[model samples]
Target: MKLYQVRKGQFVFYKNELHKVYSVKPMFRQSVHLYRLKDMEQILTRAADIELYRPKHNDTFIFYGQRYTIDQYKKPEPGDYILITKPAPDLFDHYSLNEIEKVEEVHENSVTTTKDNGVKHHEYVMLVPGKSEASQEIAYYDKELVPEEQRLKDESISYLAEKDVTLQPYVGDIYLDKRNNTKAMVVAVTESEVTFGHGIHVHIAELLDEESFELIYRYSTD
Candidate 1:
């Protein structure tokens, strides 16, 4: 079947496959930035013909005569396609694409080394939400969520931003301890001045990760 947009009109595979104009957003032009619903770059960003159509909650995605659900689409990059229909089980509400279902097809002649280098002709893409549209390029590096600055950004809150010296809790990021493996809820973070305790009010991002610096949510790492 032919692919098209979700709006009430004939969609002719425009907007660079991933990017599209929203019903409430500004008009799209050559210089204007664009954002897709989900980060398509995580999966089909490199495909010569990146075609997609969202299935109903119970439907399936058909590709090259094969049927796949959003869950099955979470193949790692460079070998197969990865799509996201669910969030991380450990992280809070953060949609994820599993990187474990990756399957690659490579040629022996593709590598020119005597020793088997761990190098295969494949892409390794772990997509996180970005904050900019192409024309309205933006980056959300700080803890505060800037709606106007970023076109479409991942819901990450930085405690180190200029907006708030005390970092607020973000939706999808990890609260890592010194080990990077043992994590907890970030609960709060301050640059060099703010003192955190049950005695004072704190940023929302910091509160969630207070106990373990870990957020309860869903994700896939492969």
Candidate 2:
């Protein structure tokens, strides 16, 4: 793991023991302060000496504020859309959905004296739904559903349209990008632009245009 990948409150392994990052100091050589999970003892380590803890099979972790379990890990190949939460060097600038044409794992010697073997690290890959695939799924659902069920769905959509509840996109809102029909979650909003995860930015006017994007879901604080 690189120094830039270390973030406070993230779980990592130091000296082969699970530890939580307590704090990070930016300096010529970044200083990472970690608390041992077993005994709560604070220890210091360098990025080169530690490894970002990889969850084992069935292990659970929060991704984008949602809890997910690790079912399996597959080697990433070309033209693969991978889901990643950690900072990947070139593939992702942030934790968001992205497509990578190629991926390679770089193995380096461990800086720690206790470990003689090198650490092998690679990007975790997971498949996500694409625009065409999603459209096909919706079409299949419409075809498979009974007439009464389809009628109910159509009526619900009409009812929502009749209500005319114009909802403003706020931070953390998830919407479907009508242009490509992919789901996106809002991360930031400005006067003229709205930014989504993975650095997707859209003009406020364009986002408000129903033809460009459709509001999917939003958490209610009430």
User: In terms of TM-score, which candidate is strongest?
Assistant: 2
What stretches of model 2 exceed 4 Å from their correct place?
1-3, 28-30, 54-57, 60-222
TM-score of every model versus the real structure: 0.18, 0.26
What's the C-alpha lDDT at position 214 in model 2? 85
Q: TM-score for candidate 1, please give it.
A: 0.18
How does model 1 fare in lDDT?
Answer: 0.27
Model 1: per-residue Cα lDDT over 66-122, one tens digit each? 223332212233334333223233322221222112223335422111111122323
| Per-residue lDDT over 1-222 for candidate 2, one digit per residue giving the tens place of the 0 to 100 score | 544577765667666445566567768364888755433346777878777754444443222112233433544333322333333443312222111111222235111111111112344434332222212221122234446564344324234333334545678889897645678898887643567775456544335434447888885677
Candidate 2 TM-score, true structure as reference: 0.26
Best by lDDT: 2
